[model samples]
Target: MDYTALTEAISSKSYEKIAEMCDDLMLQGSTEGVVNNEDWPYAIHLLGHIYVDDINSARFVWKNVPRVVKENRPEVTAAWKIGQRLWTRDYAGVYEAIREFNGSPEAQSLVDSFSEVYTKRMFQLLRSAYSTISIQETALFLGMNEEDATKYVLQQGWSVDPASTMFTVKKQAIVTEQKLDPSKLQRLTEYVFHLEH
Candidate 1:
């Protein structure tokens, strides 16, 4: 398989697309015979799944990867480590794994993207779950130092209490308008018309 497009996707940091392509390859049974090597991009594919926070899919990919690839490529192993931490909900361990990764620049970029996405997700979860939370816990969740976490929260409109060292999260109420599917409505109308006739 020509991996030119996959390389371009990695260069552009299109991780979701990478995940889709990897899925399509597996679905087509194209990767079954392919040898794992520098060109196969198994690491990128594995990291792509992890990047999307799809731990189960990531595990699936890891299980199918050739043992030689897993043994030879530290980057691939590191990516799996991150996935393992995610699966166990060890949020701090996730950051530690990323910090310890000394992989190629391409894999490094994906790891960094995953870190940012995970941090944002945790922040959203925290905001929804807490009216006020300790700064220390916020830092742990965000994988940042206390001062940096404080600054990040403040920038997000969370107020800080100097005396208690707590942050008051400003949760925005999300208003979702219901959308109607025209095709579904049309199908229902046609069924009703046939029933009446």
Candidate 2:
């Protein structure tokens, strides 16, 4: 099969589109030709799944990929390392895995996209999981240096203590009450009453 579409998707950095194409390719069969071909750009497909935080799908791709491909393509293995880190929820290891990836220039954008998505995810997790955490820990979670992490937290309206270098995470208050449409509620209530009667 021609790889024109896949190549175009990679060059355009359309990770979502690439992922869809990969899914289609996998559905066709074992992906023997596509996965093993030197020109296949399979690294982008794997990294694109990671970029979208689809760990299970990423694992499927990794499993289907031939051992020879994994051994020969360091970039493909590096991408899987990131997937493994994510699967285990090893937040620190995610950064390490990303740092280890020295993929060709084409795959760098997908890796960078994954880093951005993961950093945002970690920020949300930190806000929900910790009332107060050290700036050092936050830095690790964010894959940023301490100074930059501190600056980022401050920008997010979180308070920081200079002496201890601990940051108080600004948690968004959860609004428990959901607004219901009065007309719909009345209709549902009437229906319930009728059913009961």
Candidate 3:
């Protein structure tokens, strides 16, 4: 069946276009009562997750539908409709759906792999840019409040002024005076040096 050709076609298309393609493919496959290939179902599930992430934008392309309606059926169309509504820039909705989806047996089976890829990409970005970040900037980047950021920096053995409430560049003595495990100390030293230079 020329899977590469289909993949290229899907990749070249916009998200809505891809969703439409998946729906059509799934419906056609269902009519035959057999989807011999696993890719279509996975693609459909992915489309659902994407849709749920950005409902308004997704709805601009695909319309509003009931969430329960979307969830009841495991069909690609239903999943796509739900995904269209679920995945969004709205952090609250996204977070809730992530919790809900990850709790589901079907989603759990896929989420570990999905999250591994996501974490790797996030860490790559963090490692590339984090060292250049100032304390305030790092706080904002990490979505932490100023107090939390200050506490975190101090916890890492950096001096922070209590009165001025600023993170100082000077290294501070460890509060506990306990030696770090050798391997961990080496890693910490490497990280500190990387950040310093």
Candidate 4:
């Protein structure tokens, strides 16, 4: 297994090739229940990029990766570290992981391509916690200037006032069933007796 082609595919930022190589390596590692040690690193090295492209698929892959395999492969462990950082919204830790992987050509390639992906994902994550955000905060999170952030929010149809620097995201209204009043339920016992007849 040369693995040079896989490295080249990552370095070139060929998404299709990267996916194929990940699949191929995974298959090779598990074939006949005899795993090749090298395939673990080669496949684990691409997880960050995979996460950027398809988070659900990345989660599926992460879940399937055996704990034993992750412990034995540095790249697998490194990817796990990144996943932990991502789960906790630790941006600094994520960047640190990228830096840590810089020595590995394939992992570094994935890290370099993930800059845009990370920013978009950060916004998605923030929306779950914040229904409204100020222009300055959005700018800081998105790595853009305040004016641009304001313009972007306005373009996205966020509720904004010209005089104010904050915008509000319109979240879906939650609906709940009205609670029953025990005092109003006068005689459910009578109804039960009639049903028995």
By TM-score, the best candidate is 1
Evaluate model 2: give its TM-score.
0.81
Model 3 score (lDDT): 0.45
Residue ranges of candidate 3 with Cα displaced over 4 Å: 1-44, 47-68, 71-96, 102-104, 133-197
Provide the lDDT at 55 for model 2.
82
Off by over 4 Å in 4: 32-34, 42-52, 64-69, 72-74, 84-103, 120-133, 139-163, 167-197
Go through the candidates in order and give the clash count of each.
0, 0, 14, 0
Q: What's the C-alpha lDDT at position 62 in model 3?
A: 34
Any residue pairs clashing in model 2, and if so which? none
Q: CA lDDT of each candidate?
A: 0.85, 0.83, 0.45, 0.63
Q: What is the lDDT of candidate 4?
A: 0.63
Worst 10 residues of 1 by lDDT: 30-39
Which pairs, if any, clash in model 1?
A: none
Task: Rank candidates by TM-score, best first.
Answer: 1, 2, 4, 3
What TM-score, computed on C-alpha atoms, does each candidate reach?
Answer: 0.83, 0.81, 0.33, 0.51
Candidate with more favorable, higher TM-score: 3 or 4? 4
Per-residue alpha-carbon lDDT of candidate 1 for residues 11-73, written as tens digits (9 for 90 to 100) = 888877888787776555454676434446677788888887788998988888787887888
Whole-model lDDT, candidate 1? 0.85
RMSD of each predicted structure: 7.1, 5.0, 15.1, 9.3
Worst 10 residues of 4 by lDDT: 42-51
Q: What order do candidates take by lDDT, descending?
A: 1, 2, 4, 3
Mind sharing the TM-score for model 4? 0.51
Better of 3 and 4 by lDDT: 4
